[model samples]
Target: MRILGIDPGYAIVGFGALDYTRNTFTTLQYGAITTKAHTTFEDRLSEIYDDMTQLLAAVKPDAMAIETLFYTTNQKTVIAVAEARGVLLLCARQAGVPVFEYTPLQVKQSVSGYGKATKKQVQEMTRTLLKLPAVPKPDDTADALAMAICHAYSYRSKQYGVALTKRQQMGYF
Candidate 1:
C-alpha cells in the first residue's frame, strides 16, 4: 500500500509518501510545499492547493493520513490550518484516495510507542522505521513521515484480520 501523509499549514504544507508491504516501509518521497509569508493569504492557500494537487498526481497514494486540527489557544492559526487541511482532504478525495486523520498523541504513540514521546523521539523512531540515513529535514516533513508510518502499521495489522476497536481504529488509543 502507498500512503501519503500530510502536515497542513498555509505557509508550509509538509508531505511524505511511503510504500508498505509485509510490515516493511519504503520511503518514496518527503518534502514541504512552502508559501511565502509575505504573500496574500488567498495566494498562499492557492499555492498550497496547487502543490498538493500536483503531489497527489505524482505520488498516486492509495490513502492519505493527516494530522487533525488541535489548537486551543490560537484561533487564527487553527482556522488557517483547518482551511489548508480542507484543501488537502479535497485533493485526496478527488484522487479517489481514502483519508484518515490522526491526532498528535496518536502519532507519537504510533511512532515511538509512547503517547508522551518528545518530538525528537518520534523523529528518530520514524527514521529508524523507514531505515533512512537521517531524519527528514524540516520539522513538518518529519511529522508528515510519522503520520505515514502510523497508518502503515495500522493498515498492516488490519490486513491480517485483526479487528481494531473503535478507539484504535480512530487512532485515539
Candidate 2:
C-alpha cells in the first residue's frame, strides 16, 4: 500500500509518501508545502489547497494518515491550522482515499515504542527504522513520516481478533 502522511499547518503543511508491503516500508517522497507569511490568509489557504491537490495527483496514495489537531494556548494559530487541516481532509475525501487520524502521543508510541518519547527520540527512531542516513529535516517532514509509520502499525492492531484467527490461518494479516 502507498500511504501519504500529513502534518497540516497554514504556513507549512508537511507531507510524506511511503510504500508498505510485507511489514516493511519504503520512503517514496517527503517534503512540505509552504505558503509565504506575507500573503493574505485566504490566499495562503488557496495556495495550500492547490499544493495539496498537486501532491495527491503526484503521489496517488491508497490511503492517508493525518495527525489530529490538539488544543493550544494560541487560539489564532489553532484556528488557522484547523482550516488548513480541513483542506487536507477534504482533498483526501474527494480522492477516495481512506483517512486515519492519530494523535501525537499515538504517533510517538508507534514510532518509538514509548508513548512519552521525546521529540528527539521519536525523530531518531524514525530515522533508524526507515534506515535513513539522517532524520528528515524541517521537523514537520520527519513528523509526517512518523505518521505513516504509525498507520503501518495500526493495521496490526486492527487485524487482531478471534474471527481474524481463522482468516489468518488461511494466510492473512
Q: Per-candidate RMSD vs. true structure?
A: 4.9, 2.6
Structural similarity to truth (TM-score) of each candidate = 0.90, 0.92
Global lDDT of model 1: 0.88
Q: Give candidate 2's TM-score.
A: 0.92
lDDT at residue 32 of model 2 (Cα atoms)? 94
Q: Write the residue-wise lDDT of candidate 2 on 66-146 in tens digits.
A: 999999899999999999999899988888888999999999989999999999999999899888999998899999999
**Model 1 pairs whose backbones collide:** none
lDDT of 1 by residue, 26-104 (tens): 8999999999989999888888888888999999999999999998899999998998889888888888999988899
The pairs that clash in candidate 2 are: none
